[model samples]
Target: MKIKEGFVLHSVGDENVVVAIGKMTKKFRGMIRLNSTGAFIFRQLEKETDEKGIIDALIAEYGIDEQTATTAATTFVSQLKDAGVLDI
Candidate 1:
Protein backbone atom coordinates (compact mmCIF):
# COMPACT_ATOMS: atom_id res chain seq x y z
CA MET A 1 0.00 0.00 0.00
CA LYS A 2 0.93 3.61 -0.43
CA ILE A 3 -0.25 6.94 0.84
CA LYS A 4 -2.95 8.37 -1.39
CA GLU A 5 -2.78 11.73 -3.07
CA GLY A 6 -4.13 14.99 -1.57
CA PHE A 7 -2.80 14.51 1.90
CA VAL A 8 0.41 16.02 3.19
CA LEU A 9 2.34 15.35 6.32
CA HIS A 10 3.66 18.35 8.17
CA SER A 11 5.23 19.39 11.38
CA VAL A 12 3.66 22.31 13.18
CA GLY A 13 5.58 23.42 16.23
CA ASP A 14 6.31 20.24 18.15
CA GLU A 15 3.48 18.17 16.77
CA ASN A 16 3.54 16.14 13.57
CA VAL A 17 0.28 15.80 11.70
CA VAL A 18 -1.17 14.46 8.47
CA VAL A 19 -3.62 16.91 6.94
CA ALA A 20 -6.01 16.61 4.07
CA ILE A 21 -5.30 19.01 1.27
CA GLY A 22 -6.71 19.90 -2.14
CA LYS A 23 -9.55 17.60 -3.26
CA MET A 24 -9.13 15.22 -0.35
CA THR A 25 -10.67 17.76 1.99
CA LYS A 26 -14.10 16.71 0.74
CA LYS A 27 -13.76 13.24 2.22
CA PHE A 28 -11.45 13.62 5.21
CA ARG A 29 -11.44 16.42 7.74
CA GLY A 30 -9.14 17.48 10.56
CA MET A 31 -5.50 16.50 11.00
CA ILE A 32 -4.17 13.26 12.40
CA ARG A 33 -1.46 13.77 14.97
CA LEU A 34 1.32 11.22 14.63
CA ASN A 35 3.63 10.07 17.32
CA SER A 36 7.15 8.91 16.50
CA THR A 37 6.04 5.39 15.69
CA GLY A 38 3.16 6.63 13.58
CA ALA A 39 5.52 8.87 11.66
CA PHE A 40 7.75 5.91 10.94
CA ILE A 41 4.79 3.90 9.69
CA PHE A 42 3.61 6.81 7.58
CA ARG A 43 7.00 7.13 5.95
CA GLN A 44 7.00 3.45 5.17
CA LEU A 45 3.54 3.68 3.62
CA GLU A 46 4.70 6.55 1.47
CA LYS A 47 6.11 3.88 -0.82
CA GLU A 48 4.54 0.74 -2.23
CA THR A 49 5.12 -2.03 0.32
CA ASP A 50 3.65 -5.19 1.74
CA GLU A 51 2.98 -6.23 5.34
CA LYS A 52 6.34 -8.03 5.51
CA GLY A 53 8.13 -4.83 4.57
CA ILE A 54 6.38 -2.93 7.31
CA ILE A 55 7.21 -5.59 9.85
CA ASP A 56 10.83 -5.59 8.77
CA ALA A 57 10.99 -1.82 9.01
CA LEU A 58 9.60 -1.81 12.51
CA ILE A 59 11.96 -4.56 13.53
CA ALA A 60 14.93 -2.69 12.14
CA GLU A 61 13.93 0.54 13.80
CA TYR A 62 12.72 -0.79 17.15
CA GLY A 63 14.47 -4.16 17.43
CA ILE A 64 11.20 -5.94 18.09
CA ASP A 65 10.34 -9.53 17.27
CA GLU A 66 8.24 -10.58 14.28
CA GLN A 67 4.99 -11.05 16.18
CA THR A 68 5.19 -7.68 17.88
CA ALA A 69 6.13 -5.88 14.71
CA THR A 70 3.35 -7.58 12.81
CA THR A 71 0.79 -6.50 15.38
CA ALA A 72 2.02 -2.92 15.36
CA ALA A 73 2.12 -2.70 11.59
CA THR A 74 -1.32 -4.24 11.23
CA THR A 75 -2.79 -1.78 13.68
CA PHE A 76 -1.21 1.14 11.86
CA VAL A 77 -2.48 -0.08 8.51
CA SER A 78 -5.96 -0.45 9.91
CA GLN A 79 -5.91 3.12 11.14
CA LEU A 80 -4.81 4.39 7.74
CA LYS A 81 -7.49 2.31 6.02
CA ASP A 82 -10.15 3.61 8.37
CA ALA A 83 -9.02 7.14 7.62
CA GLY A 84 -9.05 6.49 3.87
CA VAL A 85 -5.48 7.66 3.56
CA LEU A 86 -3.86 4.57 2.12
CA ASP A 87 -4.35 3.42 -1.45
CA ILE A 88 -4.64 -0.22 -0.57
Candidate 2:
Protein backbone atom coordinates (compact mmCIF):
# COMPACT_ATOMS: atom_id res chain seq x y z
CA MET A 1 0.00 0.00 0.00
CA LYS A 2 0.98 3.59 -0.47
CA ILE A 3 -0.19 7.13 0.10
CA LYS A 4 -2.54 8.19 -2.64
CA GLU A 5 -1.46 10.74 -5.14
CA GLY A 6 -2.16 14.39 -4.37
CA PHE A 7 -1.36 14.18 -0.69
CA VAL A 8 1.94 15.56 0.47
CA LEU A 9 3.65 15.63 3.86
CA HIS A 10 5.26 18.76 5.09
CA SER A 11 7.15 19.73 8.19
CA VAL A 12 6.01 22.83 10.02
CA GLY A 13 8.21 23.80 12.91
CA ASP A 14 8.33 20.71 15.09
CA GLU A 15 5.19 19.17 13.64
CA ASN A 16 4.25 17.25 10.51
CA VAL A 17 1.22 17.94 8.36
CA VAL A 18 -0.48 16.13 5.52
CA VAL A 19 -2.49 18.06 2.97
CA ALA A 20 -4.34 17.34 -0.22
CA ILE A 21 -3.20 18.95 -3.42
CA GLY A 22 -4.41 19.42 -6.99
CA LYS A 23 -7.21 16.98 -7.89
CA MET A 24 -7.06 15.31 -4.52
CA THR A 25 -8.46 18.43 -2.97
CA LYS A 26 -11.79 17.52 -4.57
CA LYS A 27 -12.03 14.49 -2.31
CA PHE A 28 -10.13 15.52 0.78
CA ARG A 29 -9.86 18.90 2.43
CA GLY A 30 -8.01 20.43 5.34
CA MET A 31 -4.93 18.95 6.97
CA ILE A 32 -3.94 15.92 9.01
CA ARG A 33 -1.56 16.75 11.78
CA LEU A 34 0.77 13.99 12.91
CA ASN A 35 3.30 13.42 15.62
CA SER A 36 6.81 12.22 14.97
CA THR A 37 5.88 8.54 14.91
CA GLY A 38 2.95 9.20 12.64
CA ALA A 39 5.19 11.19 10.34
CA PHE A 40 7.65 8.29 10.20
CA ILE A 41 4.88 5.88 9.30
CA PHE A 42 3.58 8.29 6.70
CA ARG A 43 7.00 8.51 5.12
CA GLN A 44 7.13 4.73 4.89
CA LEU A 45 3.72 4.69 3.27
CA GLU A 46 4.87 7.21 0.70
CA LYS A 47 6.45 4.23 -0.97
CA GLU A 48 4.96 0.75 -1.43
CA THR A 49 4.79 -1.27 1.79
CA ASP A 50 2.70 -3.63 3.88
CA GLU A 51 1.86 -3.90 7.55
CA LYS A 52 4.77 -6.19 8.34
CA GLY A 53 7.12 -3.88 6.53
CA ILE A 54 5.86 -1.00 8.58
CA ILE A 55 6.07 -2.90 11.81
CA ASP A 56 9.59 -4.05 11.11
CA ALA A 57 10.72 -0.64 10.09
CA LEU A 58 9.18 0.90 13.14
CA ILE A 59 10.87 -1.59 15.37
CA ALA A 60 14.22 -1.05 13.72
CA GLU A 61 13.91 2.71 13.75
CA TYR A 62 12.73 3.03 17.31
CA GLY A 63 14.09 -0.13 18.88
CA ILE A 64 10.64 -0.85 20.21
CA ASP A 65 9.28 -4.30 20.95
CA GLU A 66 7.30 -6.21 18.34
CA GLN A 67 3.96 -5.89 20.08
CA THR A 68 4.28 -2.15 20.49
CA ALA A 69 5.35 -1.63 16.92
CA THR A 70 2.54 -3.82 15.62
CA THR A 71 -0.07 -1.94 17.58
CA ALA A 72 1.16 1.46 16.51
CA ALA A 73 1.48 0.52 12.85
CA THR A 74 -1.93 -1.13 12.77
CA THR A 75 -3.69 1.75 14.44
CA PHE A 76 -2.03 4.37 12.25
CA VAL A 77 -2.82 2.45 9.04
CA SER A 78 -6.44 2.10 10.05
CA GLN A 79 -6.67 5.79 10.73
CA LEU A 80 -5.17 6.63 7.37
CA LYS A 81 -7.49 4.21 5.62
CA ASP A 82 -10.54 5.64 7.35
CA ALA A 83 -9.39 9.09 6.34
CA GLY A 84 -9.15 7.96 2.68
CA VAL A 85 -5.45 8.63 2.60
CA LEU A 86 -4.11 5.19 1.75
CA ASP A 87 -3.90 3.48 -1.64
CA ILE A 88 -4.37 -0.02 -0.29
Candidate 3:
Protein backbone atom coordinates (compact mmCIF):
# COMPACT_ATOMS: atom_id res chain seq x y z
CA MET A 1 0.00 0.00 0.00
CA LYS A 2 3.01 2.35 -0.34
CA ILE A 3 5.54 3.49 -2.88
CA LYS A 4 8.60 1.27 -3.13
CA GLU A 5 11.91 2.37 -1.63
CA GLY A 6 13.85 3.25 -4.80
CA PHE A 7 11.30 5.52 -6.48
CA VAL A 8 11.51 9.33 -6.55
CA LEU A 9 9.58 12.28 -7.88
CA HIS A 10 10.86 14.93 -10.27
CA SER A 11 9.59 17.93 -12.16
CA VAL A 12 9.89 18.47 -15.90
CA GLY A 13 10.85 22.09 -16.62
CA ASP A 14 7.57 23.31 -15.19
CA GLU A 15 6.69 22.71 -11.55
CA ASN A 16 3.23 21.56 -12.52
CA VAL A 17 4.56 18.57 -14.43
CA VAL A 18 5.85 15.66 -12.34
CA VAL A 19 7.56 12.37 -13.19
CA ALA A 20 8.54 9.23 -11.32
CA ILE A 21 12.00 7.63 -11.14
CA GLY A 22 12.94 4.12 -10.27
CA LYS A 23 16.32 3.15 -8.95
CA MET A 24 18.96 1.58 -11.24
CA THR A 25 17.77 3.52 -14.25
CA LYS A 26 19.03 6.86 -15.56
CA LYS A 27 15.88 7.40 -17.59
CA PHE A 28 12.59 6.84 -15.86
CA ARG A 29 10.55 3.99 -17.30
CA GLY A 30 7.50 6.22 -17.26
CA MET A 31 5.32 3.42 -15.95
CA ILE A 32 3.01 5.84 -14.29
CA ARG A 33 1.93 9.35 -15.24
CA LEU A 34 0.02 11.40 -12.70
CA ASN A 35 -1.74 14.72 -12.98
CA SER A 36 -1.65 17.28 -10.15
CA THR A 37 -4.44 15.65 -8.20
CA GLY A 38 -2.91 12.22 -8.54
CA ALA A 39 0.45 13.66 -7.56
CA PHE A 40 -1.09 15.11 -4.44
CA ILE A 41 -2.46 11.73 -3.51
CA PHE A 42 0.88 10.10 -4.21
CA ARG A 43 2.71 12.60 -2.01
CA GLN A 44 0.22 12.04 0.75
CA LEU A 45 0.78 8.29 0.58
CA GLU A 46 4.50 8.91 0.94
CA LYS A 47 3.87 10.72 4.22
CA GLU A 48 1.15 8.44 5.56
CA THR A 49 1.29 4.74 6.31
CA ASP A 50 -2.06 3.07 5.80
CA GLU A 51 -5.16 3.37 3.65
CA LYS A 52 -7.25 4.83 6.48
CA GLY A 53 -4.72 7.55 7.21
CA ILE A 54 -4.49 8.45 3.53
CA ILE A 55 -8.26 8.59 3.22
CA ASP A 56 -8.51 10.76 6.31
CA ALA A 57 -5.84 13.14 5.12
CA LEU A 58 -7.45 13.52 1.73
CA ILE A 59 -10.82 14.14 3.32
CA ALA A 60 -9.38 16.79 5.62
CA GLU A 61 -7.36 18.49 2.94
CA TYR A 62 -10.01 18.44 0.23
CA GLY A 63 -13.12 18.77 2.41
CA ILE A 64 -14.67 15.80 0.74
CA ASP A 65 -16.82 13.04 2.22
CA GLU A 66 -15.08 9.93 3.50
CA GLN A 67 -16.67 7.66 0.92
CA THR A 68 -15.70 9.88 -1.97
CA ALA A 69 -12.14 10.36 -0.79
CA THR A 70 -11.76 6.68 -0.04
CA THR A 71 -13.00 5.74 -3.47
CA ALA A 72 -10.61 8.05 -5.25
CA ALA A 73 -7.66 7.05 -3.11
CA THR A 74 -8.40 3.37 -3.57
CA THR A 75 -8.66 3.73 -7.32
CA PHE A 76 -5.45 5.71 -7.51
CA VAL A 77 -3.57 3.15 -5.44
CA SER A 78 -4.88 0.34 -7.63
CA GLN A 79 -3.63 2.15 -10.70
CA LEU A 80 -0.19 2.50 -9.13
CA LYS A 81 -0.16 -1.19 -8.33
CA ASP A 82 -1.10 -2.08 -11.87
CA ALA A 83 1.72 0.18 -13.11
CA GLY A 84 4.29 -1.51 -10.80
CA VAL A 85 4.95 1.67 -8.86
CA LEU A 86 3.73 0.37 -5.50
CA ASP A 87 4.88 -2.59 -3.46
CA ILE A 88 1.64 -3.41 -1.76
Candidate 4:
Protein backbone atom coordinates (compact mmCIF):
# COMPACT_ATOMS: atom_id res chain seq x y z
CA MET A 1 0.00 0.00 0.00
CA LYS A 2 0.91 3.63 -0.33
CA ILE A 3 -0.32 7.03 0.68
CA LYS A 4 -2.82 8.55 -1.69
CA GLU A 5 -1.64 11.38 -3.88
CA GLY A 6 -1.81 15.01 -2.74
CA PHE A 7 -1.29 14.17 0.89
CA VAL A 8 1.95 15.70 2.14
CA LEU A 9 3.68 15.49 5.46
CA HIS A 10 5.06 18.62 7.07
CA SER A 11 7.23 19.10 10.08
CA VAL A 12 5.61 21.31 12.66
CA GLY A 13 7.14 21.90 16.09
CA ASP A 14 7.66 18.47 17.58
CA GLU A 15 5.06 16.78 15.44
CA ASN A 16 4.50 15.77 11.83
CA VAL A 17 1.22 16.87 10.27
CA VAL A 18 -0.31 15.60 7.04
CA VAL A 19 -2.21 17.94 4.79
CA ALA A 20 -4.38 17.49 1.77
CA ILE A 21 -3.92 19.40 -1.45
CA GLY A 22 -5.15 19.48 -5.01
CA LYS A 23 -8.08 17.14 -5.62
CA MET A 24 -7.69 15.60 -2.19
CA THR A 25 -8.90 18.85 -0.63
CA LYS A 26 -12.50 18.07 -1.52
CA LYS A 27 -12.58 14.88 0.52
CA PHE A 28 -10.11 15.69 3.28
CA ARG A 29 -9.99 19.29 4.37
CA GLY A 30 -8.04 19.12 7.61
CA MET A 31 -4.53 18.06 8.48
CA ILE A 32 -3.80 15.01 10.57
CA ARG A 33 -1.24 15.25 13.34
CA LEU A 34 1.10 12.30 13.87
CA ASN A 35 3.52 11.29 16.55
CA SER A 36 7.13 10.31 15.93
CA THR A 37 6.21 6.71 15.22
CA GLY A 38 3.34 7.70 12.98
CA ALA A 39 5.61 10.07 11.10
CA PHE A 40 8.10 7.29 10.46
CA ILE A 41 5.40 4.95 9.25
CA PHE A 42 3.94 7.63 7.00
CA ARG A 43 7.31 8.17 5.38
CA GLN A 44 7.59 4.49 4.62
CA LEU A 45 4.12 4.53 3.07
CA GLU A 46 5.20 7.23 0.65
CA LYS A 47 5.94 4.55 -1.91
CA GLU A 48 4.56 1.12 -2.74
CA THR A 49 5.08 -1.19 0.22
CA ASP A 50 3.62 -4.02 2.27
CA GLU A 51 2.82 -4.76 5.91
CA LYS A 52 6.04 -6.77 6.46
CA GLY A 53 8.14 -4.01 4.94
CA ILE A 54 6.60 -1.39 7.18
CA ILE A 55 6.92 -3.54 10.27
CA ASP A 56 10.54 -4.30 9.49
CA ALA A 57 11.39 -0.66 9.01
CA LEU A 58 9.78 0.25 12.29
CA ILE A 59 11.67 -2.47 14.09
CA ALA A 60 15.02 -1.44 12.61
CA GLU A 61 14.46 2.23 13.28
CA TYR A 62 13.13 1.97 16.81
CA GLY A 63 14.63 -1.33 17.96
CA ILE A 64 11.17 -2.41 19.02
CA ASP A 65 9.83 -5.94 18.97
CA GLU A 66 8.04 -7.17 15.85
CA GLN A 67 4.73 -7.65 17.64
CA THR A 68 4.64 -4.13 19.05
CA ALA A 69 5.67 -2.54 15.79
CA THR A 70 3.06 -4.51 13.88
CA THR A 71 0.36 -3.40 16.26
CA ALA A 72 1.27 0.27 16.03
CA ALA A 73 1.72 0.23 12.28
CA THR A 74 -1.55 -1.61 11.83
CA THR A 75 -3.40 0.96 13.92
CA PHE A 76 -1.92 3.92 12.05
CA VAL A 77 -2.57 2.40 8.65
CA SER A 78 -6.15 1.74 9.72
CA GLN A 79 -6.50 5.42 10.56
CA LEU A 80 -5.28 6.46 7.13
CA LYS A 81 -7.64 3.96 5.59
CA ASP A 82 -10.51 5.42 7.60
CA ALA A 83 -9.57 8.92 6.46
CA GLY A 84 -9.52 7.70 2.84
CA VAL A 85 -5.92 8.70 2.32
CA LEU A 86 -4.24 5.41 1.59
CA ASP A 87 -4.09 3.32 -1.57
CA ILE A 88 -4.58 0.00 0.07
Candidate 5:
Protein backbone atom coordinates (compact mmCIF):
# COMPACT_ATOMS: atom_id res chain seq x y z
CA MET A 1 0.00 0.00 0.00
CA LYS A 2 1.09 3.58 -0.61
CA ILE A 3 0.03 6.94 0.65
CA LYS A 4 -2.30 8.72 -1.72
CA GLU A 5 -1.17 11.77 -3.61
CA GLY A 6 -2.07 15.26 -2.33
CA PHE A 7 -0.93 14.30 1.14
CA VAL A 8 1.95 16.03 2.85
CA LEU A 9 3.88 14.86 5.89
CA HIS A 10 4.88 16.98 8.86
CA SER A 11 6.44 16.64 12.29
CA VAL A 12 4.26 17.71 15.16
CA GLY A 13 6.36 17.56 18.30
CA ASP A 14 7.68 14.00 18.52
CA GLU A 15 5.10 12.57 16.15
CA ASN A 16 5.19 12.37 12.37
CA VAL A 17 1.91 13.49 10.85
CA VAL A 18 0.13 13.21 7.49
CA VAL A 19 -2.04 16.05 6.26
CA ALA A 20 -4.18 15.94 3.17
CA ILE A 21 -4.18 19.17 1.22
CA GLY A 22 -7.41 20.02 -0.47
CA LYS A 23 -7.38 20.77 -4.15
CA MET A 24 -8.58 23.77 -6.20
CA THR A 25 -10.71 26.21 -4.24
CA LYS A 26 -11.07 24.09 -1.13
CA LYS A 27 -9.20 25.20 1.92
CA PHE A 28 -6.01 23.30 2.78
CA ARG A 29 -6.44 21.00 5.77
CA GLY A 30 -5.54 17.67 7.21
CA MET A 31 -7.91 14.86 6.42
CA ILE A 32 -6.19 12.09 8.37
CA ARG A 33 -3.90 11.67 11.34
CA LEU A 34 -1.29 9.03 12.12
CA ASN A 35 0.97 8.33 15.06
CA SER A 36 4.74 8.15 14.85
CA THR A 37 4.84 4.42 14.25
CA GLY A 38 2.13 4.61 11.62
CA ALA A 39 3.98 7.42 9.92
CA PHE A 40 7.18 5.38 9.88
CA ILE A 41 5.40 2.44 8.34
CA PHE A 42 3.69 4.72 5.83
CA ARG A 43 7.02 6.17 4.80
CA GLN A 44 8.44 2.71 4.25
CA LEU A 45 5.44 1.70 2.18
CA GLU A 46 5.87 4.81 0.13
CA LYS A 47 9.43 3.78 -0.77
CA GLU A 48 9.43 -0.02 -0.95
CA THR A 49 6.32 -0.68 -3.10
CA ASP A 50 5.67 -4.14 -1.63
CA GLU A 51 4.63 -5.73 1.65
CA LYS A 52 7.66 -7.97 1.94
CA GLY A 53 9.99 -5.05 1.38
CA ILE A 54 8.15 -3.03 4.02
CA ILE A 55 8.51 -5.83 6.54
CA ASP A 56 12.21 -6.17 5.84
CA ALA A 57 12.80 -2.46 6.12
CA LEU A 58 10.92 -2.29 9.40
CA ILE A 59 13.01 -5.09 10.85
CA ALA A 60 16.23 -3.43 9.79
CA GLU A 61 15.26 -0.02 11.08
CA TYR A 62 13.69 -1.01 14.38
CA GLY A 63 15.77 -4.12 15.20
CA ILE A 64 12.53 -5.98 15.87
CA ASP A 65 11.83 -9.62 15.20
CA GLU A 66 10.18 -10.43 11.89
CA GLN A 67 6.96 -11.55 13.49
CA THR A 68 6.72 -8.39 15.58
CA ALA A 69 7.48 -6.15 12.65
CA THR A 70 4.99 -7.96 10.45
CA THR A 71 2.24 -7.63 13.03
CA ALA A 72 2.91 -3.93 13.52
CA ALA A 73 3.05 -3.28 9.80
CA THR A 74 -0.18 -5.17 9.25
CA THR A 75 -1.97 -3.13 11.87
CA PHE A 76 -0.67 0.11 10.47
CA VAL A 77 -1.69 -0.90 6.98
CA SER A 78 -5.18 -1.64 8.20
CA GLN A 79 -5.43 1.81 9.72
CA LEU A 80 -4.38 3.46 6.47
CA LYS A 81 -6.83 1.33 4.55
CA ASP A 82 -9.64 2.29 6.84
CA ALA A 83 -8.76 5.95 6.43
CA GLY A 84 -8.81 5.67 2.61
CA VAL A 85 -5.17 6.72 2.48
CA LEU A 86 -3.76 3.51 1.10
CA ASP A 87 -3.43 2.94 -2.65
CA ILE A 88 -2.98 -0.81 -2.56
Candidate 6:
Protein backbone atom coordinates (compact mmCIF):
# COMPACT_ATOMS: atom_id res chain seq x y z
CA MET A 1 0.00 0.00 0.00
CA LYS A 2 0.95 3.63 -0.39
CA ILE A 3 -0.13 6.92 1.02
CA LYS A 4 -2.86 8.46 -1.10
CA GLU A 5 -2.01 11.48 -3.20
CA GLY A 6 -2.32 14.97 -1.72
CA PHE A 7 -1.25 13.94 1.76
CA VAL A 8 2.08 15.49 2.68
CA LEU A 9 4.34 15.15 5.70
CA HIS A 10 5.90 18.21 7.18
CA SER A 11 8.29 18.82 10.03
CA VAL A 12 7.22 21.46 12.46
CA GLY A 13 10.06 22.35 14.82
CA ASP A 14 10.59 19.10 16.68
CA GLU A 15 7.29 17.53 15.67
CA ASN A 16 6.04 15.86 12.51
CA VAL A 17 2.57 16.08 11.01
CA VAL A 18 0.58 14.86 8.02
CA VAL A 19 -1.78 17.22 6.23
CA ALA A 20 -4.12 16.86 3.33
CA ILE A 21 -4.23 19.16 0.30
CA GLY A 22 -5.96 19.42 -3.07
CA LYS A 23 -8.73 16.87 -3.51
CA MET A 24 -7.63 14.98 -0.43
CA THR A 25 -8.95 17.79 1.70
CA LYS A 26 -12.44 16.76 0.66
CA LYS A 27 -11.95 13.35 2.25
CA PHE A 28 -9.69 14.34 5.12
CA ARG A 29 -9.17 17.56 6.94
CA GLY A 30 -6.94 18.78 9.76
CA MET A 31 -3.54 17.41 10.60
CA ILE A 32 -2.35 14.21 12.18
CA ARG A 33 0.57 14.44 14.57
CA LEU A 34 3.20 11.76 14.59
CA ASN A 35 5.96 10.63 16.86
CA SER A 36 9.38 9.54 15.61
CA THR A 37 8.28 5.97 14.88
CA GLY A 38 5.12 7.13 13.18
CA ALA A 39 7.15 9.54 11.08
CA PHE A 40 9.44 6.77 9.94
CA ILE A 41 6.56 4.49 9.07
CA PHE A 42 4.83 7.28 7.20
CA ARG A 43 7.91 7.88 5.10
CA GLN A 44 8.01 4.22 4.15
CA LEU A 45 4.37 4.28 3.22
CA GLU A 46 4.99 7.19 0.87
CA LYS A 47 6.06 4.59 -1.63
CA GLU A 48 4.38 1.36 -2.63
CA THR A 49 5.20 -1.28 -0.06
CA ASP A 50 3.72 -4.09 1.97
CA GLU A 51 3.59 -4.65 5.73
CA LYS A 52 6.51 -7.08 5.71
CA GLY A 53 8.69 -4.52 3.95
CA ILE A 54 7.87 -2.00 6.64
CA ILE A 55 8.59 -4.60 9.32
CA ASP A 56 11.98 -5.33 7.84
CA ALA A 57 12.83 -1.66 7.54
CA LEU A 58 11.86 -1.10 11.14
CA ILE A 59 13.95 -4.02 12.32
CA ALA A 60 16.95 -2.78 10.38
CA GLU A 61 16.58 0.80 11.42
CA TYR A 62 15.71 0.26 15.09
CA GLY A 63 17.31 -3.13 15.72
CA ILE A 64 13.99 -4.37 17.09
CA ASP A 65 12.83 -7.98 17.05
CA GLU A 66 10.54 -9.39 14.37
CA GLN A 67 7.45 -9.39 16.57
CA THR A 68 8.09 -5.87 17.75
CA ALA A 69 8.60 -4.57 14.22
CA THR A 70 5.56 -6.42 12.97
CA THR A 71 3.35 -4.98 15.67
CA ALA A 72 4.57 -1.47 15.10
CA ALA A 73 4.14 -1.59 11.32
CA THR A 74 0.78 -3.35 11.50
CA THR A 75 -0.65 -0.96 14.04
CA PHE A 76 0.50 2.14 12.18
CA VAL A 77 -0.81 0.88 8.84
CA SER A 78 -4.13 -0.04 10.41
CA GLN A 79 -4.41 3.40 11.93
CA LEU A 80 -3.73 5.07 8.56
CA LYS A 81 -6.30 2.83 6.91
CA ASP A 82 -8.83 3.68 9.54
CA ALA A 83 -8.09 7.36 9.01
CA GLY A 84 -8.58 6.97 5.24
CA VAL A 85 -5.05 8.13 4.45
CA LEU A 86 -3.68 5.04 2.79
CA ASP A 87 -4.16 3.63 -0.72
CA ILE A 88 -4.50 -0.05 0.02
Best by the lDDT measure: 2
RMSD of each: 1.2, 0.6, 2.9, 0.8, 2.7, 0.7
What's the ranking of the predictions by lDDT, best on top? Answer: 2, 6, 4, 1, 5, 3
lDDT of each: 0.91, 0.98, 0.70, 0.93, 0.73, 0.95
Cα lDDT of model 4 overall? Answer: 0.93
Model 4 spans with C-alpha error above 4 angstroms:
none
Which stretches of candidate 2 lie above 4 Å from their native place? none
Instruction: Give the better candidate number (2 or 6) by TM-score.
Output: 2
Please provide, for model 3 over 6-31, each residue's C-alpha lDDT reduced to its tens digit, 9 standing for 90 to 100: 56666555443334545524544544
Better of 3 and 6 by lDDT: 6
lDDT by residue for model 4 over 1-88, one digit each (tens)? Answer: 9999999999988879999999889888888999888899999999999889999999999999999999998998999899888998
Question: What would you estimate as the lDDT of candidate 1?
Answer: 0.91
Flag regions of model 1 displaced more than 4 Å.
none
* Poorest stretch of ten by lDDT in candidate 6: 21-30
lDDT of 2 by residue, 13-86 (tens): 99899999999999888999999999999999999999999999999999999999999999999999999999
Estimate the TM-score for candidate 6.
0.96
Query: Which residue pairs clash within candidate 3?
Result: 1-88
Q: Please report the candidate that would top TM-score against the real structure.
A: 2
In candidate 4, what residue range of length 10 has the lowest lDDT sum? 23-32
RMSD of 4: 0.8
Tens-place lDDT per residue, model 1, 13-77, is 87889999899999889999998888898998888998899999999999999999999999989
Higher-lDDT candidate among 5 and 6? Answer: 6
The local distance difference test score of model 3 is 0.70
